[model samples]
Target: MKINPKNGVDQLVFGMKQNHVENLYGTPDKQFKDEDGNVIYLYNKEKLRLTFYEDEALRLGYIITSNSEATLLDQKVIGKNIVEIKTELPFKSWEQEDFDSTENHFNESNWLILQSEFDVIIRVEIGAIINDNDEFDWKFKA
Candidate 1:
């Protein structure tokens, strides 16, 4: 699903496969396949560390800071709900545009548009899970 930053609406939808990571974000710098056949890819860019994983069938992705104390910072910053995090640090219009451009090229279940102060906007999506859980689970479906 693609989101409209100007409005809180879902714009488009597409299908994706289990090995579609590169198609979505190009090749990753480091790739690790666990003993259980789960794959994890790491992409390092400036202050950001993008981690993509197919853990047991669930497609889990996250981004974190790459500062010297990144591990400590991650422990403090990771796993917060979007609403809680966004309330403290509102997204800007330019960021929304960047997000829209990046995410629209990929496949998602459903997308959402969120507005903030200064007319800023953000697009969010419920991504797929590639793990070994129940196949019919709709947890990520928006």
Candidate 2:
């Protein structure tokens, strides 16, 4: 399935299925049964995660990496439930002390939707990578 660059998260979730997801990302590293007897597939690579619940994709995570650590680029919710996203990175940075901490260096944007009494939130962040560049050359949908 083709992903709409303007709304990549939505396109991903809508296009995902058991066969399509596995074909694109390959077989999951681990698989197990949940309490409800549904199968859950987990793939934890350096910068990618494709999780499936009950043979349906529940979440997809893609990480963007720099010289240091990697930051998640895309996260999509597929189930009929609410989910929360979080990061352990602090909110402040001490540039004066050469600490270059994540605190105060994180930048975030989000898209939220409420449909059929279910809420979905897509959080996008640039992390420390944004501070290193004076300008960005992203091309959005026209």
Pairing residues by index, what is the TM-score of model 2? 0.31
Q: Work out the TM-score per prediction.
A: 0.30, 0.31
Model 1's lDDT to the true fold? 0.33
Q: Which regions of candidate 2 fall more than 4 Å away from where they truly are?
A: 1-15, 46-51, 55-142
lDDT of 1 at 47: 32
Global Cα RMSD, each model: 13.6, 15.6
Which candidate wins on TM-score?
2
Clashes of 1: 8
Candidate 2, position 129, lDDT: 14
* TM-score result, candidate 1: 0.30
- For residues 35-112, what per-residue lDDT tens digits would candidate 1 score against the true structure? 665555555642333333454243443332322222211222222333454445334222243233231211222222
Reference-based lDDT, residue 31, model 1? 71
